[model samples]
Target: MSFLELKNIHKSYHLGSQTFPVLKGINLAFDLGDFVSILGESGGGKSTLMNIIGGLDRNFDGSVTIKGKALNHKNEKALDTYRRETIGYIYQSYNLISHLTVLDNVLVSLDMTTLSKKARVLRAKELLARVGLAGQIKKYPNQLSGGQKQRVAIARALASDPKVIIADEPTGALDSENTKEVLRLLNEIASEGRLVITVTHSEAVANAGTRIVRLADGKIESDKRIRQAYDRQDKEHLSSRPLRRLASIKTAFKHFRHNLGTNSLIIFGTAIGLFSVILFSGLGNGVSHYISSQITKVANPQVMSVSRYVKDSDDDNALSMSTDDTPALSTNQLDQLKKQKHVAKVEPTYSIPSATVSYQNQTVKMRYASNWTAASTADAIKIGHAPKKAGEVVIDQDAIAKKLDKEHYQDLIGKQIQLAYQTNKPSGETVTVSLTATISGIGHSDSKGAQVNAVNTETLQKAMQQAGLSTDPTEASVKVDTLDHVEEVASSIDKVKDGHNRLYKTSTIQSLIKQLQTYVNIATFVLSMVAAISLIVSALMIIVTMFMSVSKRTKEIGILRALGESKRDIRWLFIAESLITGVLSATVATVIAYLAQRGINGVLRNLADYTFVQITFRNVITAFFLAIMISLLAALLPARRAAKLNPIDALSAE
Candidate 1:
């Protein structure tokens, strides 16, 4: 039996219900070490016949038997295996991957074999040396002359040690000197116990083969033996050579590196989106921390603030009424709060949002003031003493300096100041009260305002009653027995119900911190969402870039498939390229966010007590993962399109 046989092959092309027969009942046979050339005119079906024999075109009616077994054309994997292990095609155009070096082009074929990476490189170099291009192995195809490129193509064909070498006009584009050299190489290949088949229209090329076959109108017109075929005493069995997945990644990275300019822009665009998300999250955390710290300074953890929250009753329109008409915490409510678990003391206090104090014609507008108790006053006094008796008051030193001269401010510590504020009478009447009090001490100022003032609660209550104004406390300050029970006592106070089922709204240092944190989280989420919109643009950019890459690398895709890579391998190549871009972008974004955090903190160091932006590992990692996932999803369509391209069509692409 012949080593390779094509028995009665018939083929046709269909164009919209029109059948054009190309091959008409052709029979051919070849043994190992046979150098056969098929000569034909331009439209004599010679190319189609070569395609069928090389396992590239399967749409034919034929029995292709190799070693006495018929080829299963319907099995895709079987066809790929046959092409990989048994056939090496040398195209006339020398279709080499433009980005790969000459040696790398040869290794593309060997990547499918079981040879180790070092062994493959060694073999590729040897093949290049054999083709007289050893010194030019690192050069790209475009850097080589036509003759040299053809030599490189021949080296690539021989790299896999294929059983059959198919040269489709291998020297058609070469001059006389190069043509002679290429023909000698083909003959040498035939002498190496391999079947060499060359298809050409030149009669001189056909005469160089050991056997000559002529075709006319898709039919074999003549067959002549010019010389004896090499004898095959020992038969070699072909082994399976599957494509290596990592080889595609290496190839993809090579292509990406080759076009770094465009890919860099893509990576930068993606990094911007990731940087925004990471930086904003860190900023929110820092802002929340700053707010919580400020709150801690204002409210002691062992102290809880309780206020009456009047629910709408059916008997009254309380929502439409003024603050004076709204209910304040009555005496019974304060007594009840003081009786709760872990309650050490409850101080009924009256708060006024706007107040005025005057010392001898010098006046200052106080933004906040509240009737004070001994427990509240003891923590804030910086000089002199707190309000221990009926007519004493403590004021902020910063507020006093802003109003009076510095010399006068020091001498006014024992001087009397007139305090005035609006109040509500029991008969639903409004009145203004002006009371005189001695300045007993000074307190620290805050960011909100410098007007921190406190007067004795009992003295203020008596002054309100004498002025015919209701003196019921608007808010009560509950002092917990211990700092550990502050949260528990606050919760209990919040849940305390009256006969009308109304509970007091409670605020503690811990609760205030939580509320501020919640606000910060909401702001962060909103900012992150706004930043994430850029990722859509980034994803679109990735899609466009990947599609452009696929378009530009069409021929490369064809070369890989021709070298035994499956469609899945081609798809993975593009996906790997996209992932590489994503990871690089993520790294850049993380670095930028970290630097921004440091810069922001440095700029705000003197203004605030703590850092303003904190970039955590979680934010960095999340940003990176999101970037990669978006890029991978964006690349799916381009990858599938590349994988589905026909190798023959791709090879013919301009």
Candidate 2:
């Protein structure tokens, strides 16, 4: 059976305004080790027939059988596999990948192979040696002669060890001497037991083949067998060029250089986007960390102990402390708490109605309930020191500046202010208990979720008892550093109070910290998502740039596509271009994001003592993934369009 057989091939194209038919009905057969040359006019379908045979174009109605297996029209995978594994091609324009080194160009087809990089290099070298280009393996396509480049193209074709080799106008671009040199190489390749098919106008190329096939108007006109002269080396000028290597990374790098400008711009755009997200994410992390540190700094631990209750024992009390009729503690009872086994410090607190200020015959109505906290912990003071005595008031800056007198914001500090304290007893008793004090110092405004109006705990308890409020040791309040010693502390207080004294270990600062953390997380996430849009734009920008590039490079891609590369390989080249751009952009974006976040953090530190964390490794990795996806997505359409181009029309395009 023949190695390749074409049975009644027919192909046409829609030219917008008209239909152009190239191949009428073509029938041909060629045996293994045969070399056939096709001569055709410029308007003829020589390149079109080549495209069909090479599987780049399947729109034609025909059967191209290789090794008795007919090419499938419906299954794209089958066609791809057939093209990948079966065909070897060299084109008239040399079609040497311009960006690849001579050696690397030979190994491009073996990317997915299990053969080690070194093995692939070795094989590529052997093929280049066969084509007499062994020394120029590291040289780029432009650096080689026309004849030498064609030889490299041939070497690339044979690298996969295919049974059929097709050469379309292999000598078309060469001078007479180089043309003769390339034709002789073809004769040698065919003699080595592989089918050689050539399409060209050169009679010499047609004569050199062992079997010649001529085409006119896309139909086979003649098929003839010819003799090859003995002592082929006499006509073959041999060069001892060492084998070339398939430098995959190096090849990619060259294309990267060739298309650097367009890619860099797209990458820059994407990087800007990632920068916004990374900075915001970092901001969130840093803010939460700082807030948590602050919370722990001020928190005193709570003491926990079980309570035993009587039936409705003290239910009649108004400022009620009794739950299930529990009685309250006396001053002596509260003082006895210090003697408990594991007791540390205990303080009692009572509530009062909102104080009404009377100054200069004017009465200001106060609304929100007034409360206080233990002033022992220094971290609780955001302004001047805690109240030195009961008559001294520590006013927060927020209250003095905004709530009091905005015109004389700072004047209120250190001034005497009268407080009319109204007390409510647990026994449903109400009394007008008031005090006069001076604003000793101004404190900073406390954030939300903080316990406001903190004062000295000891003074607070005395005032509560005077107002007939509960100071029960059984329900006493105490603060410790941690929850670890709650049981020990609770056991000691159990003796003084009627019921177990419950140490309420609530962290006001901690609540604020959680709020800060939530704000940061949301801010960072939102910013990051918004930044992702820029990356997407950058990706699509690559597609647009590539499409424009394809428009500019249509002929170049057409030349490569006609060289028997599968549509995937063609598309991959375009994708490869975008992929390089994406990676580069990621690297740039990460650097920019780091610098940007750091700069913003520096500004914030100036406002107060603040430390902001920089963008994480996680953020950088995310940017990388996004860049790749964007670049690939951008390349998809242009690559597909390039792959689907008809070689004949492409070649015929001016």
Q: Which candidate's lDDT is highest? A: 1
TM-score for candidate 2: 0.67
Colliding pairs, model 1: none
C-alpha lDDT score of every prediction, in listed order: 0.83, 0.64
Q: Identify the candidate with maximal TM-score.
A: 1
Candidate 1, superposed: residue stretches over 4 Å from native: 231-241, 300-304, 313-323, 330-332, 338-347, 352-363, 371-397, 401-472, 478-495, 507-533, 604-610
In the range 340-369, model 1's lDDT, one tens digit per residue, is 999998987677656777766877777777
Off by over 4 Å in 2: 12-21, 112-114, 130-132, 228-254, 300-456, 463-511, 516-533, 549-580, 596-608, 625-629, 639-654
Q: Give the TM-score of candidate 1.
A: 0.84
Residue 606, candidate 2: Cα error in Å is 5.2
Residue 513 CA error for candidate 1 (Å)?
Answer: 5.5
